[model samples]
Target chain A: MNHHPTEPQETIVTDMPDRPALLKRWRPRGAVWLAAPAVLVLLLALAYPLAIVVVRSFTDPAPGLDNYVWFFQSAVNRTVLQRTFVVAAWVTLVSLICAYPYAYAMTIVGRNLRLALILCVLVPFWLSGVVRTLAWVILLQDSGVINSFLRGLGLPPVKLIRTLPGVVIGMTQVLLPFMILPIYSVMKGIDTRLLQAARSLGAKPWRAFLQIYVPLSLPGVYAGAIIVFILSLGFYITPALLGGPRSILLSSLVQNQVLSLLNWGRGGAMGVVLLVATFVLLAIAAPLMRQKHSSTRREA
Target chain B: MRNFAGALALTMTCALALPVFAQETPVAGAVKEGSLEGKTLTFVSYGGIYQDGQVAALQEFVEKSGVTLLNDGPTEIAKLKAQVDAGNVTWDVVDTADLPPYVHCGTLFQKLDFSKLDVSKIPPGQVGECSVPAMNYGVIFMYKTETYKDNPPQNWVDFFDTEKFPGSRAIDGSGDPTGGLIEQAFKAAGGDPKAITPDDIEKGIQKLRDLGPDTIYWKTGAESQQLAESGEADMIMMWTGRAMTAAKNGAAYTPVWQDWLVVMDQMTIPVGVKDTDAAYALLNAYLGQRSQEILTEKTSYTPIHMDAKPQVDEITASFLTSTPERIAQGYQQNIPFWVENFDLAAEKWNALLSGN
Candidate 1:
């Protein structure tokens, strides 16, 4: 972290004595100007398209609430929407189960081993999503390696691909890094002496760790849960290839409406529904997250 | 007619499209070589082996015209609608195979200028208000040879009989080749294939869904071919175009060509095209006998031009939809039924796919 080589540049900036005066004059308003380009880009790319979709949901193919009525009336749409949330929740839960011990281990590992653990998470995490999902498809198919291995073990070949658990497994592998990194980062910051103090006060080892460390890790778990659940909701390709028709999600329904059915109004309405559902979930989650955030802050 | 001439003349001098209005116009896509230099046309289709053949068919035409040929899609009518609605129609010519947007009623596709095209040799009733028939492609049931070597499944009844010849099957889930698959399935379920009503759609989908739990529903022609190539399914209800390609590529499949169901996919200039003359020129070239020959040769989809006889290899020959023997049994598309109830069938098909 040494920056002795860059001291000359820092000295040069300080040598220009008017630099402080210039900074004092422009600091407040310069912040807004500096942020303007990013803010404008966000508005154009994100907000504008969203606005079009929301507007189209209401106004397209003759205005009214007909699209909403259509969406609600379709039993298939309701089923798919429910399936999407359920799959997302399952994926989040699966990732948590797989990631918690790995994250805890990472906190207790030596520096080199910790780096190795992170690399294991990152290399696959940075791989193309389509490629990764396709790899899972290869492993999980009926005549795939997993079934072959199971058959070799004198066990009946289990149905994994095109099932709900198959979707969760593929999603968990991709999302475990989200779970691991957050929990690991928070764990790394915790004071280990507190656990020792609990033990010194005659608390059992498991109880001390659970009562102290587990509460401290709640913020990270919540953050990871929020990310994995929200991201899983929007998943399209993995489920399409790896999951069967019974596991069809909301995104596929949206695609069916917009592309196949040529009903953009219905698609837009469906999209607006997804957006509203996500926002409502987020609104409920925000206060819970804030409360956890403040408790963590107080503990720190 | 005068407005067409005016529209044509807008591109160049008064003489450029003058002879286009004459009874003796130039042959389809016949132009002074390089006259269309710097011009562009975007060709859109249900891509895969078929689009590749189309691109090859247009090679000389594109080269001679010196027009920059831009390739685009796996076409969708909704995308065509969006392009037209936005008033920035990038796609010049689009090929729609499944569901043909017959209910679109000439809104998304232009009313093609028959004057500009060479439709003389094209079969009667093949020409529509907004488009020309691209090719005669059959959506037929093809089964893996080794899977059913004992006693081959013969007709739609045999196709739905899972207990007799049980193996995984792949069939069209999107549109179900509209009439062919559904009508056949309806008949297989003991309904009249000839007089298929909206009420028969559920019966058809029910028959399809009854194909057992081992069935996979394919959404695209390419996906169906992938099913063939991967040997992922024992039986596939797929296009002859894809079947031909798959067989040539070493897929072991034999079409149970009974009750041959033939359909001609249509080509159209989208409603708000950039250059009507240029777009028409591409369409004309694509419709020419030589281009049609190459297309039939490569894809085994029957040529629209009556005189274009393609010299296909044995594998391609077996899958050809327009054979005299096959055509004798061929059931042409029930377009009217589909034109009215395409959405209903699509919904039911999707519901069946969702395992409802």
Candidate 2:
């Protein structure tokens, strides 16, 4: 906390007479050049396709608002949109519920043991999404291993395929890694001494956890929720396979529009709608995320 | 008669043209004796037997033609559209399902020229101005032969009658409204399958919902086979290949080819393919009877050529709509009707599948 402004230092590189002008002129320009490649990549990968989608959504196959209108008016499209939100909300909630305990465990575990646990959490990362999804098929089908084991014990087999439960189970499986890692990373940095301190002061373990650990780990929770929710919204395969007839998602609809219907404009419109919904969620998340970020910085 | 003279002259011209066409075509895809092939031809096709048959049939062509075939798929139309938009057409030919070519039309696929190939070799009514039917598949009802040794469900009507069958069945959960199963159900219930109106589609879907809680939905061809193999499903409305595979995998199941929906995979050049000559040569090779016959034997799929006799076992031959007797019962999917009412059909189909 040395706040002394007592010493004035002489500039060593004052050989340039216009040093102030030179510094002012060159710094932001240098930063811009440094950022140019990243900006260009983003433009190429993200912005350009998005621009095309937006354009196509507006001007394709007669250049009118018909595609957008079709999306809103079509019962199938409306149902799919509703289903997407429902699935996203459920995934976020489930991931939150499931990850909290694991995240808490990561905090209290020994530092050496935490690395092993973290590795366990990340083991699925090495497998392709399609492979993991195929594994879910082997596990969840009517006569699959899960049902067979259940039935062997004199229990009736549950109709797992083409049901909402199947979709949620498959999706939660696909996105569990996304949910766990962020929460674990945040929890690991929490000062557990505060919980011990609270306990020493006669606070119960649950209360202390609720007051200290839960709030502290919320940045990770928020991050994990957004990651899970956003990813779940765009889920294509799991919902298409495992979910029942009525459980159509926006991604599947976009595929149907492009492939089955052969209407690119309609597909593009659905894509833009999906993108905008995600963007809106992210936009709403920004203020809370910024506040959490600041609280994290302050805690640090 | 003028028709006789015209036919004779046409035959004479084609006889003269055949040798030239055959000789000049493969040279475009000419192989070097002991040198590496320079270019890669990307092939987009549906997975499993469809791809297996196609690649197997074209193996000799690849050896002779010297064009390296880069296989890619479970063909996604959205991916094709994206690639086209990006100005990167990776696939020279895309062997997709029946409905896509009709939906995308000239935008996604090129209008094919039949004059380049010998059309007389092909079956009647398959050569389209825009597309050529490459292979035939049927969507038919299947049941485990062991399930009802004496009282087996025989027809589409029996498939819908849950009371008599008293077991779960598998249908596609892909939300394809006009998926062959639903259409068959409609037809079995005395709705004219060909003249399916919006109301008829609704009725058909209601019939599906009635079949209801006992129904299991399979998403992929492999899943359908697994359903049959595991014996969870006593019966299923399945694609022909899956039914064939299930039987091959020692499942005691057999298909009811009666009133089956016959579908064709069309081979058309996409609108902006640069290698049209190579595409044409590939198309010509694909039309050859030897290739078709060999493909039919290995894969359960029927060939497009009229002259090719498929070498199939009794069970598989019984299952195939291409068999003389089964062919009579099966109906060709009316592409014109589908094309005309595509937008409406798409919307209605989606609604029906979504249970709206």
Candidate 3:
């Protein structure tokens, strides 16, 4: 680990030789062609279709923002959107709380146990999200294996399938690796001597771990939380299978609009709203992420 | 003596079932043994066990006609429309849900050339301008026998009586609301099914809403079937074919047939598909007696052909929606009404979904 803090850059852009030299240093002109195919594919496959969706949101069934208006007018859409955010937030929080300790454990564990823990996260990656969700459905349904076990213990069976908590559990399980890996990598780089230094000086064990270790791992926490949160917003299968009607989220609403109602304009409007919300969220998160991460890395 | 009687019984059953077959001597849609050699027609359907059955149904045709049939799709209208719009249709024959043929008829889906295809053997009034019946099933409900034991829920009115029935109700949440259930609910609330209006949809939704915390809207046929198989819900409204599958899975349930909602899937050719004759031949073959029986046996959907007697098990036989008694009791969905006010009804259905 880089325990020696590096000095800040002393170079200034105003002292650059010329525009051409700076541009060359930034990126060579000849290297531009190498990115053409990827850019073209992105434009055709991603941007072009996304543009049509955005445009259709405005133009279809007569131009203007009527589709968005229609969407907002419906209480169902509002509740679903709210539910989507609430569920995503819960999934992120739960996974982060569950994952942090595990990730921390990974940093401290011996090689064999670390390998086994890493296998725990990576084995699930082999199964598709739908397959995993279906397995969860089988396990979580009424009179399922879980409930049967619970009943065997002489306790009332807890309702997990078709509930918000069930959806959160399914989603958190699926998204745990996203949370764990980033935090583990960041924790691996942080110097343990800093924690020991705090403990030796005056800080108690809890205070030292909280004050020294947590602040340093904030960057990984932010990275993982952002990924888990954003991905959860668009989750369909997990909630659809594990959640009841009360737990319907925004993606399923979009699916209902486009696939069921065949209302592309409304569906496009929902998609555009979700996209804009994500972008705005990223914009707000980026500066906070950068500032805290930079300050934390400096301390480390 | 028993073997002789069994043979005699089989012969008599075949004799009775071959009337429609007798009328079409050369088999109206049959081509010469190798007429379609080197030609390939792509068949698209909602893939899985159902699509597998469809492929099985066409095997005889594939062998006899030498036409290579390829399988693809869980049918999406947008994909079909795109192919037709681009005039590069790869999907030759497409099996779709009930609404698509009627909705996209002459635009995206081709008007059937009945000269090349024969619909005489298919059920009357089901031959749409652009399509023929793929199979017939119903939006039927199965009640857990253990839950009801003695006082089983008998009909739609009882479906909503949570106090009497007193268990969870799993309704079909497969996008569009089932018109049969709506009309039934409306009728149970002292409204006439034949005179159902836009306001009546709201009434029915209210009836469903009254079921309250006990109601669950199962999103897919498989989900509904799962509800039945596991007895997760005391009563589950699902497709007849799915109920059959659940019964096969050893679900202990009794199907309430008081007014099993009439339903069917349709097969249509995309407008710009290549090799229309080859497609027609396959469609014709799909309607034949042996093909219908095979489709029925494999998929558990009742055949649309008038005289195809599938040798199904007792469970499948019970689930068949096309039997004379079931048909007499069946409540046909007001398709014209539904198609006209689909969006408005969807608004109410969505509201009901979110109310919980």
Judging by DockQ against the true structure, name the best candidate: 3
Native interface contacts kept by each candidate, as a fraction: 0.45, 0.66, 0.52
- Tens digits of per-residue lDDT for model 1, B187-295: 8888888888889899988888887766777655766776787677888887777887788788888888888677888888888888998988888888888899999
The order by descending lDDT is 3, 1, 2
Rank candidates by DockQ, best first: 3, 1, 2
Worst 10 residues of 3 chain A by lDDT: A3-12
Off by over 4 Å in 3: A1-41, A297-300, B1-29
Which scores better on TM-score, 1 or 3? 3
Candidate 1, A165-213: lDDT as tens digits:
9988998888888888877776776677778988998989999888778
* Full candidate order by TM-score, most accurate first: 3, 1, 2
Clashing pairs in 1: none
- Cα distance off (Å), candidate 1, residue B166: 3.3
| Candidate 3: tens digits of C-alpha lDDT, residues B53-110 | 9899989899989988888898888777667767899999999887777666678888
Top-lDDT candidate index:
3
Backbone clash pairs for candidate 2 read: A162-A244, B110-B269
TM-scores for all candidates: the values are 0.87, 0.83, 0.89
DockQ of each: 0.40, 0.39, 0.47
True lDDT of residue B259, candidate 2: 72
For the predicted complex of model 3, DockQ is 0.47
